[model samples]
Target: MSGERRESGDVRGILHPGEQARHRRLTRLTVGPALSAFADRYWVVRWDLRGRPAYRAEVLSFPCVNVTFERSDLRTGGFVNGVCTTKYVRELSGEGETFGIRFTPGGFGAFTGMDVGVLRDDSAPLAEVLPAAAGLAERVLAEPSDERRCGLIEEFFAGRGRAGDPHFALVSRIVTAMAEDPDLTRVDQVTARFGVPVRTLQRLFRRYVGAGPKWVLCRFRLQDAADRLARGDRVDLAELATDLGYFDQAHFTREFTAEIGMAPSEYARAASPGQSVAR
Candidate 1:
C-alpha cells in the first residue's frame, strides 16, 4: 500500500523529477520579509539543450500567480501568469534563462486592487499590469547574475510605494493551512478552522486566489499524489484515494485521469527509469 502522504510534504510539483536534472537547473530563492506580503519567492531556471533533443518540462502548479522574465532563443519577454488550474507544460531547447516571481495567492490582488479571477488560466505582458515595469524586463534579462536580477525585481516591487494589504496576511495564513493540513478536505472544514463564514471565504478567494478554496485543497492533494507516484513509490490506489478524501477509488481515478491526463498506474510506469515520459 502507498504510505500516507500529507499536503505539507515537500512536493516541488515537477511531474518528471527524475528527468529534470538531465536538461535544466532550477533554483528557488527565499522571499525576503520586506516583500513577503506581496511575493512568495524568486526562481531561476537555466537550461542548455544544444545538440540534444528538446525536453518537455511539466509542472503541477500551485494556486498562485507568477511573473516571469525569460530570455531564450525562441522567446524573450516578461509575462504575468495567472493561476493555471491545470497542469503546466513547456518545451526547452537551445540555451536560455528565466527569472520568475511567484506571488502569494492573495498577493497579486493587493497590488492592482482588481479581482484576480479575471486572470485565471490566462497570462498578460508584464507591461500591461505594471506600466512602470515596461522597461524592467529588458534590464532583468540583460543581467547575467541571478542575485542581481532578483534585486532588480525586488526593487521594482518595493518601490511601488503601495501599502501592505491586511487581507494578504489573512489569505496567506488560510492558504498555508490548506496546503499543510491533509484533513482539510472539505470547505466546511476550512470555515470551521478559520472561523470565516462560507460566503466570505468564497468571496475572498474569488477576488484574490482566482479559484475556490475547494479547488486549492484538491489541487494540493493531487500534487502530493503526483509527486509520490512520479517517484516510483509503490502505492495502493484505494488507500491513496482514502487519504485524499475521495469517496472511493473510482472517484479518485476519474478525477486524477481528468486532471493529469493519464491513469495513476500509467503515470507510475511512465516515470520508471528508461521510460521516455514527455508531458
Candidate 2:
C-alpha cells in the first residue's frame, strides 16, 4: 500500500497518485474491527472506495479483498478473496468503486476458525468464503453498530470453537501492549509484563503471529513513528531511539532499515516534505 490520505467527515479515505495526475481514491465506509474483549482477533471494518482514473497496488497479503459490484466490457466486477502473506502488487484502473474488509492476523482465525498461519501462504483464494463474509459486511455497514458487528465476529469464532486458542490469548496481550507504548516496549518488556520467559514468548509469537516477537515490536514501533511523521510531526531520531528503548541512534537506524528497507535519514527524507538532512 502507498501513503494514506485521510478523507473528510465521519468517513476515512486514501488517495494514491500514479505516474500521471491520475489517482486512485479509496473512500472507507465503516472500516473497523474495533478492539473488543475477544482474544487475539481484530477486524478492519468494511470500506467503500472509488478509484479515480487508474492505479495499482502490490498485494502484500490476502487478508483483504476487492469486491466489485459493477463492471463494463472495459472493466470488471467481483470480489478478490483469500488470505495471503506473500507480496503481490497489481495495477488497478477504472472509476466507480465499492467497499472491502480486512481480517487482522488472528482476526481471520476468529472469522474462519482456521489456524492464523493458514494465511501465510499467498496462494489460498478466499473467494470460496465471500458470500457469508460479504453478507456480514453489508449488514454492519448499513447499521453502523459496533455491538452488532462484534456479535457477528464472535458468532463466527463460536462456530469455529476457536475461542480457546492458546495462541490467540498470547498474541492479544502482546498486541495490546504494543498499542499502549510502541516506543517503550520490547520482547523482554513484554515477557516481564506477561510473566513469561523469553523463550515462551518467542514460541507464542511464532505459533500465532507468524513472526518473532522482536520483529513484531519493531514493525509496530516503526509504523507508529511513520504515522507520526506522515501527519507532520517534527521528530528527533536520536531522541526517538532513546525514548523507544533503543541503545542509540546507530542501533535504531540499523533496525529501521532492516524492516523498512531504508535507512532512518533516507526514510525521513522520503517521508517528510521539508525536513532538513540529518546531521
Q: Best candidate per TM-score, number?
A: 1
Model 2, 223-256: lDDT tens digits are: 5544443443567788777766778888878876
Q: What would the per-residue lDDT of candidate 1 be over residues 1-279, giving only the tens digit for each residue? A: 112222222445877676776688877777755567688678778899999999888888888889999988767899988999988888899999888888888888877676889889998889998788989999998888777777787787775635667676678889999888888789999999889999999989989899989899889888887876776556778888888888888888888888889987787777655433322
lDDT per model vs. reference = 0.80, 0.47
Q: What is the lDDT, from 0 to 100, of the residue 43 in candidate 1?
A: 76
TM per candidate? 0.89, 0.60
Q: Considering summed lDDT, which 10 consecutive residues are worst modelled in model 2? A: 12-21
Among all windows of 10 consecutive residues in model 1, the one with the lowest summed lDDT is 1-10
TM-score of 1: 0.89
